[model samples]
Target: MKLGELFQEIPMERVHRYAPERSLDLITNESKACRPGALYVAIPGQRVDGHWFLKEVLERGAEAAIVQHIDESLPLCQIEVPNSRRAWSALSAVYYGHPSRGMMVYGITATNGKTTISFMLDSILRGAHHKPGLIGTVKIRLGDELLAAQMTTPEAFVLQRYFREMADHGLDSCVMEVSSSALEQDRAADVAFDVVSFNNFSREHIDQHGSLEAYWQAKASLITQASSKSVAVINLDDARIRTLQGQSAASFLTYGIASKDADLLAVDLQVSGPTVSFTLLIPRPVYLAGVDRTVPAGAWPMKVGSPGQHTVANALACCAMALAGGIKPMDLAPGLLAYGGVERRFEVLYHGPFTILDDHFANQSNIRTTLSSLSQMDYNKLHICYAIRGNRGVIVNRENVAAMAPFFKDLRVGRFIATQTLGEVTEKDVVHDEERAAFLDEAVRCGLAPELIPPLDEAIEAVLDAADSGDLILLAGCQGMDLGAGKILTLLAQRHPEQKAKILWPLNDRVCGQTIPHPPNKKETQQ
Candidate 1:
């Protein structure tokens, strides 16, 4: 492709000997990934600048370079753009032939439930025979193939390349989690989304985004990015999302559990054991392909395999996306039930006379939801082993402890055991002084006494020793609890060696295990 054509959408500052016949087959921002015919774009980043590697890229036979400023020292074909990041995204889409345009793409942005919605949407699209691809926090799926995710959202260049791969692999639809950082970085600048959903938002990424408002803006930008041709699925229950009402120009599809104004509303809900069933009140009808009748407007009995109010919100968001895309409500009902669920979103790691559940309780909202759900479950004893949050600063730790304290005030079951995860987690995953002080203060203030154990392994063992057959053991936390599922399996082995082979299969289903296509560069639990 010609270098001039690729810069059509990008504002060019100057064009210095721009080659119209330069056969640029590959594009990269990283010099290490550049091939002989690749065009290397110099993007100024926080840690490193690609411009400094100009000599290396040119030496490796790069055809051209797109940069913020002209490198007068080198005579390589250069196209100077106002913003390299935007230019990189625009050019990659052009080079990849805008693969996302050929497929139905749903971009879900939320503080939570992005991964869950992606999986639910994948299942729904598949129910209609639309071969679906997924790119989210858990993993990347292209039809039958799965790769572990490196981040919530990939860089624009890498993302476009993956879309191109999916297009060639014969996937008709793709669902991805669009992170706030990704939006700020201009990662999804080029993908033409068919549907965009904002399930819910909470106080998260405050440190990285610098403020609550900045974080909200990052999430809101995704919904606002939708073209008039697209459908924006908004969660009416999310107070942050409610502010986005009458905000975007795209055709809006509203979903909620409590809001009667929602076009796709769930009512008459029932939660029993591991499943939750609800009556989906579809006031608006949607077309069903190759069927005599449309998805008739009425209360359609819908059930999700997962529990929790958050799961209901996720289900409603996916159902709204499918309905807006013209899929039947009847078809989606089965899909939601079929989704076995991703790892660590309140996954039951073990089930016997007692049950062991592991959850990724990263933020305050998640902690509150998980605790509330656990309180409702039928168990003689509830033992919670929480690995104290690390890396996340004082504010988050304060909110988390506050959330925990109120729920455990009555001590419905056994005492809570807190772990610093000494050897089980990375050094960065170790609890800080502020986190410790916040937790202890909140626990005492709420009139609850939680046992403090420094080592996560010992804390976990403490829970196991205290648990009876009719008890429920909850392994919870963020980075530190990555080893929770594995550690529990090891402990379970010691408790009952005879049950080893029968329960060993769940370890493969864990987030840290090979069940997902995890990149080699991604961090593992320190244990």
Candidate 2:
């Protein structure tokens, strides 16, 4: 691509030096990765500024540079931009042939359920016989190939590369999980989206975004900036998400279980052992993706293999986005029924005499949802092995414990086993004394009288020993609880030796958090 072509529509503050006809072989933000014919983008970051590395990148033979600040001493062709990150996104999209425009792109942004909804959309598109790709926290799917995902939303360059690969391979659509951080950094600024959903929001990433309003604004941008031709799926049940009403120019598709004005409502919902069945009541005419026509007012009985009120909400968002993209309503049931679900989002590991469930109970909202879903199930006893959140600040830990307090009283929780995961977590996730104190103090105030368990393995063992025939054990936490599933399953296999294969084989090939990608370099880490 020519240097002039890459800057076609990107706004620039000033052009320090121009090399319009220069043919660039590569584009990168990393100074270390610059080659002779490469274009380097200088991004200002929290700890390290790409501008500071200008001297290094130029010395490494970068042909030209995009910068927010012009350095007169560097003998380089520089295109000064108001915002380097946004320019990088725009340039990368252009360099990749604007691949997203050729496909039916679906973007899902929320505090939770993004991964499950992405997977649900992928299944729906595949059921309609349209080749689809997925970009989410669990994995990135480009046709039949699967790659480990480093974040909920990849950096702009990596994201564009994935879209380019998908488009070039003849894939017809993509379902991507857009994150708050990604939006704040303009990582997904230039991608074309056909359908965007703002499922729900809660207090999260406050520290990263510096405040709650900033975080909300970041998530809201996805819907507000959507094109008029696209569909914006909104969760009417959430008051915060409701504020987005009348804010977007795109067609609105509202969904909820309680809201009467919802365009799509889930009625007669039933939560059985491992399935959630609901009657999807479409109140009016809506676009059906698969049939390429409008679907009249109707109610369809839909069933998802994954059980929970939260799963029903996720399915509703999936149905709305799929229908908007031309998928027939008839295909929704099978697509959702076939979805096994993402790992650690109320994942069931054992269902024999007793039940074992694993979940990433990260924040207050997630805890409320997980516990509320468990309240609907029948069990002899509910044993909660909670791995105390670590390194996430005292306020977050206190709030998480507080969220569980009401559920503890309501569900008559059998036991609360808390673990610090002393040896299982990395240095960044290590539980500090203050965080532990906050959790304990909050639990005691809420009458949770939690028993302290040191290591994660011991916590799992304690839960297993306390489990009865009709008991339901929940292995819950964030990074600390990632290995909980495998540990508990191994313990179960030992206890019931004859059923080892049945206990472990089901999740043998499907488990996550085991695969480790190559360690990133310093520049890649900063991005």
Candidate 3:
């Protein structure tokens, strides 16, 4: 593929130079990974700029350099643009030969449930025999191989490269969680999605986005990016969905529990232990033209892997996406039944004398949903051991604490321990003690006596000791709760090896553990 052909959609001024004659073998970031005649994109990132290592990339046999500014002294062919990020995304799409164009891509953005929906979509697609690739917070999958992902979304160049790899690997469809920062920065600018799904938004990433409206705009951009022929699936149950509808150009498809006007709606919902079944109502018969017929404007029995009202909504969103993309409704039932769910989203680790839920509720909305889900489950006492990140934005932290407080007050729980993950970081430059104190005070005021433990390990131990048989032990947090959860699970297994048979890993699917990819010259640190 020629560089000239790749930048056709982009204006000529944005296209500084095109090396048509040069044949590139690969696209890379690390100098060592660069092969001869490879396109090296010099990204100016937090720690180090790729421009500083231009000589090394050239020495390792890169043919050209895509950069924001040119370094005339370098011997490599330089292509300068106003924004290197946008250029990288455009070039990657071309380099991958526009893999998304060959497949139905669904981009889902939200503060929570993004991972679960991605997994659901993957299972549904596989059941229908359409090979699906996934890219999100957990990992990236191109068919059977799983690649560890550092961020919820990767940089433009890396993302495009993965798309190309998926295309080569014979994936017919791709489902990804599009983060707000990724969209705001143009990481997904070049890719055209077949369906864009909006999950509920909340106050998150305020530190980077600066305001709630800006964060919403970043998420809304995904819907706007879709073509008119593409389908925009919005959750009518979410208040923010109204704002997104105004920004979308794609054909509208709505799903909700409360809204009767929704194109696809859930009715006759029933929640049993570890299984929630629902009836899906489609307004009209969906025809794929030559493909199979979906639901004939009637209710279809739908079963989700997890036991939560939120899961029911997530299934509805997945159904909307599948239906919009021409997937038959009959095919959805088998796929949905087979879905074990995504890891760490209200996962049950132990259920012997006591029940242990390993839930990752990072934001305010998620915290509320997880608590509400637990309330529905039968338990004598609900003992919650939660940790919050110190670096999270002030508004998010406040809202998360406030939302969680009401749930804690309602819980007939024996105990609730609210702790900080990172040991109090209070200094002249950073004062997080007050924020931490505020969260504890808020929880206590909500009717439950909340305690603040310095370290997460101690908090877990204290909570477990208080829990008895028929009681629930829940470890919920966004950061490094997995480590604590893993350790606790091991301890529980060793203490009650007989109960090991009862201890269930969330999702019921095993992911091969791998290190997340990092930029050049960066050190890997455990969070």
Residues 188-294, model 2: lDDT tens digits: 99899988999989998776788889999999999998877788889999998998976977877788889989888999988765788899999998653323457
Off by over 4 Å in 3: 1-63, 71-76, 285-296, 419-449, 501-527
Off by over 4 Å in 2: 20-26, 35-37, 287-293, 412-415, 422-433, 516-527
Please state the error at residue 407 of candidate 2 in Å. 1.3
TM-score of every prediction relative to native? 0.88, 0.91, 0.85
**Candidate-wise lDDT, in order:** 0.79, 0.85, 0.75
Task: Give the winner by TM-score: 1 or 2.
Answer: 2
Prediction 2 global C-alpha lDDT? 0.85
Estimate, for each residue in 206-313, the C-alpha lDDT of model 3 and write its tens digit: 877878889888988888777776778899888877666646557777789998877788988987578889999887764422223343577788988778888899
Clashing pairs in 3: none
Worst 10 residues of 3 by lDDT: 518-527
Model 1 lDDT tens row, 1-527: 77667766667788776786877667778887666668899989887988999888888778889889888788787888888888888888987789999988889998876777888888878777778889988788766667877688998877987898899899888898999998988989899888888888889889778999999899899888777777788988877798786677677778888887777888887875578888889886644222222445777888888777567777888888887777766788878888777677888888887888988887877888888888778888789988778877777877787788777744466858988888766566678888787777777877667799988778888988888878898988877787778877888887788999766668764555334443432111111
Worst 10 residues of 1 by lDDT: 518-527
**Pairs with steric clashes in candidate 1:** 147-517, 148-517, 148-518
Q: Which rank order by lDDT, best down to worst?
A: 2, 1, 3
